[model samples]
Every structure is written in C-alpha cells, then in structure tokens.
Target: MKSELEKREILLESGTNEVEIIEFYLGGQSFGINVHKLREIVPYEPEAMTSLPESGPSMKGMLLLRGKTVPLVDLGSHLRKRQVENSVERKVVLVCEFNREVNSFLVDGVNQIHRISWKDVKPLDDFFTPYKPRFTGCITVDGREVMIVDLEHVITEIFPEQTIFGEGEVEGAEEADAFKRGSRQEVKILVAEDSNIIRNQIVSILKSSGYEQVTSFVNGEECWNGLNMLKAEAAHKGQDLREYADLLISDIEMPSMDGLTLCKKIKTDPVMKELTVIMFSSLINEQLAHKCQEVGADGHISKPQIHALVKMLDEYCLK
Candidate 1:
C-alpha cells in the first residue's frame, strides 16, 4: 500500500487543467466527454444483441464485450428526445469509464478530438435554474458550442448507492497530532461536493487548520447516507445526535439531489434541524446567496477562496 505522502504526490502530479475530449453529436447539438475517461468508440452494429429491459429507457440496454456485460444508455435520449433515429454513418456507441466502472452510451455521430482548457470553459445559467440541466458549462469549438457534462454527477445520478470511499480511515494520523494540541477548538464540518478536485482541496485546508473529525461526501445522496450512519452510531453510543457533525458545507449544484434541496431536507428533518448549513460554490452573487438562504442555508461562500474558507471554518465551525 502506498503511504499517504506517496498518494498525495501522485495526485499532485496529475494537475487539474485542460481536458482532452471526444466530441459527438446528439439531438443536433454537440457534447464532449473527457478522453481520459473514454475507453473506446465502437460502431453500432445492428447484429449486436441488446439485453436492456423493455421498460428500461434511460440507457438502451446492455452489450456483451469480451466476457463483461456493459450497460448502454441512449446518449440522445439522455439529452432530449426518446426515440432516437440513427443513420448508418451516425450510429455509434461511446464506451466510457465512470467511477472506474466502464459503461457505453449510444450517440448519433462522433466528432474529432478537441483539446480545450479549463480557462475556456464557462458556466451555464440554465443549470442554475429549477429545470434539470445536464452540462456544467459550454466550450466553444471552432466557433461552435460544445457542452461539457459533469461526469461525476451523471454516474452518481445513475448509481446513488455506490460509496465514494471505503470505511477505512485516511492515513497520516500522526501528522494531525500537532492540530489537536492547538488552542483553536476543533471544527465539526460536513462537506457535500461532487467534484474531486474541490473536495480534496477543502479537506486539505481543513486538516491543515487543526480541525479534526471532518466528514465528506460527493453528492447529496452520500451526505444523507453519511448522516444516517452518524446518527445510528450516535444512538448506539447513547450520545446526542447534535453532538455529531457541527456544520454543513455543500456545493450549489450536484446529482441525486442538489445542495439547496439537501439543505432544505436537513433543516426539515426533526433530528438534524439545527445544524449550520453553508452553500460554498464558484457560482456566487447576492441573488444566489439570497436563493441559498431561501433553501435554509445559513451562509454562502465563493469558490477558490481558500482564505475565506479558512475564516468561515473558524467562525462557524470552530465556534
């Protein structure tokens, strides 16, 4: 097993930057998935036997590859229409990996790979609206718009029960010894974010701040699961449920359930009604904060603000 230091080094080497994508057409619009996550593209052969149930509609069905059975969803249907019309030249199945699990989706046609940087991506206002939106942002490819979908969100949406991490605690327990002795009170924090990059950074920041007992989750569903686990453990110990996680920090957008909805649910639940919930995200504005407040969030913080995050942790969580 690699030590914590070694693992951290490897993650640092994989810098977050431009993602190479395989662009494809669905519903006459273009979409892109990270080439790093895509394994291959197979032509949609009519002779291929599909094992998907007649009632199953989101993903068309399953395809046999080698000895493994992979579920295939109609990419076009996921975007808009249900009955997808495919031509011989356009019909193709996109084989991609999600959460280390390989799955396939049928697309109308494939386009050439285009290298787009993170700086070129811009957020979609449609996603912030009440209506369900798929893509996180749009990247302009040769004057045309290409939608960038959040892969983590889509996968977790399909499989809510899948655990993001195991029960084994993170290593480097000794590295946190210095934090325990510090005069600063340990902060009780719960983070619900879908992105790995942001989650790791926030966790790192909190750990460095002498804060212990931090709990994290990828989406709202996982947050609920964690809360239930914490509650059950507390009951077993005969401890107050409020003595568990101190504060709730969540992103605005997520899959399986959004942060806004999660905050409302937490506040409405009789057992967890008093926890402090904050909406921490890059999408920030006075109007958005007001919207978060409406959803029962105690406060809001803009993203990439490490200093602000530390300060907030001290104020709300440390107190």
Candidate 2:
C-alpha cells in the first residue's frame, strides 16, 4: 500500500501550492485522487458485503466499516470499463470522505502517493469518454501519466439527491436583501471554482438568493489575472480593489493555481490585501481549516454547505 514516497513522513506547508495524489488502478488503467479525501484503505472482502436488490449497476453493496454503513461503489463499472467486476484483479476498497459524507470506492489496486505541485497538474477533458464528470485532470508521475479523478463528481453521480441547493438557505437572508436593495443593485462577487457542475451550482444558489453580480473563473490563476486587470483600472481612479468587488469565493483544488496560494498572493499584495477571500472547498475539515487561516482567508466553508455560505455572504457582503 505504501511506496517509497509514502514511506517517509510527509509535511506539506500551507500556501506552498503543492498536493499529494494517491494513485490507484482500475481495469488496468491508473487513476489519481487527492490524498486528503482518503479516510482509510482496506482490502476488499466479498464475503463481508451484503448484496442489496435493485442496486444500481455501479453499486456493489453496502459495508458496515467501523460501525458506519457506507455504500461501496464500483469505480470500474461506473467508468464503463470491461472485465472489471469479473476480472482477476487485486480488489481494494478506498474509504473516502468529502463534502461531509463517507463512501467507499472499489478499485483493482492502489499504487503510491505522489507529491506534486498544482501547477504541474494539467486540466484534462476527453470528448471520447462519456464519464467527463469523473475526469478532473491529468498529472505525470514517474514518466507515466495518470488521470486525476474528481471524487466529488463521482459521489454526486452515485447520490444525486445530495446535489440540490434547496431554497431554505435563502429564507432568512431577506433582511440583508432589503439593505442591499436600498444601498445597491447586487453584490459583485468573484468566484474561482474549477468544476463546472459545482461552479454553476454556487452561481445558481447566489442568483437565487438575489446576489446576481457574480463573475466566475475556472481556476485561481484566471481569477488572479482578472483581479489584476480590475486592480489596474481601480488604481487609475485612485481606488482599491474592494470598491469594485465585494468578495472572492475560491476552491482549494484547481489546475494552474490553488485557493491557498491565490489567497496568500492577494493578502500579501498591498493593492488587493483589503479584499475579502472566503475558501469554499471540500477539503475544509477541522485539520485543514488552519491552512485557510495561514493563507489569510477571512472565512472557510465546507462543500455542500450552501446555507452556511449564504449566511456568510449576508454577514460579510450585504451587511
């Protein structure tokens, strides 16, 4: 389960723009996932799983791992790979947690954890594959290329009920809406999120809550460039960047640049230091919360917690 890279203790400092990706195999192809998403790994035991009737093709069954009933999803079947479920493969279960939910993914085997910079991970989208949502990007390790799997996208497919941004989160924000309507038209928000589905979800939620003046970028690199352009015009008028934008909503994992590195750049720059930066990422657990603080993020919210994000916007922007 461990490679030479994983043999030693790994200490990654906050805001360094580096990431650890775990390589795993499925149907003879290698895939990568963020190391932070892993809760634990265990050998797959067919005798331990209780089969359920009418389960989806990808759903193998549910397992009671450490007293928690977690659904096991077959990564190979979900990705439409042949000879995976019945093939002679080294079965392993990767227990992963993200967006405050736990799920295990069945894979052939896991290789090793590789330490790489976010800059090296190139954004990849293959038109030939129908599972575009599961494809996040690609990274080269040991002279071999591996596709980075977006677990958020995978879990969303398995449980579509969890993706909805309900209207309940906007009910109490009317008071702030009143103030905003009287003071301005809409709050100018800059969002930097890579996933199209999640980015659109956030934008839809914001517009539904009456915050319509939102600008979105695919990654922190593009967002940062957009800010510098905005800064130039504001500088010419002897104004700060905050006057033009209310706040920035950024995700921690992206291709060219990550949120923490982007936040650090913004906080350290005198021109953009006053602007508020909020981290809205799946990696915002208690352990990783301090990294947000280290990068000078004003606030941090976990993924799928759209209600909390709405409230934070009310307190920070509308108020």
Tell me the TM-score of each prediction against the true structure.
0.49, 0.91
- Provide backbone clash counts, one per model: 1, 0
- Residue 167, candidate 2: Cα error in Å is 4.9
Candidate 1, residues 30-81, lDDT tens digits: the string is: 8887554466778886557475555345657777776677877776665564
TM-score of 2: 0.91
User: On residues 105-214, what C-alpha lDDT tens digit does candidate 2 reach at each position?
Assistant: 99888888888899999766556367667877899887888999888887778787766354466554455556565443467899999988889989977776677888
Question: Candidate 1: which stretches are off by over 4 Å?
Answer: 1-16, 82-90, 126-133, 163-319
Best by TM-score: 2
Report the lDDT of model 2 for residue 110: 86
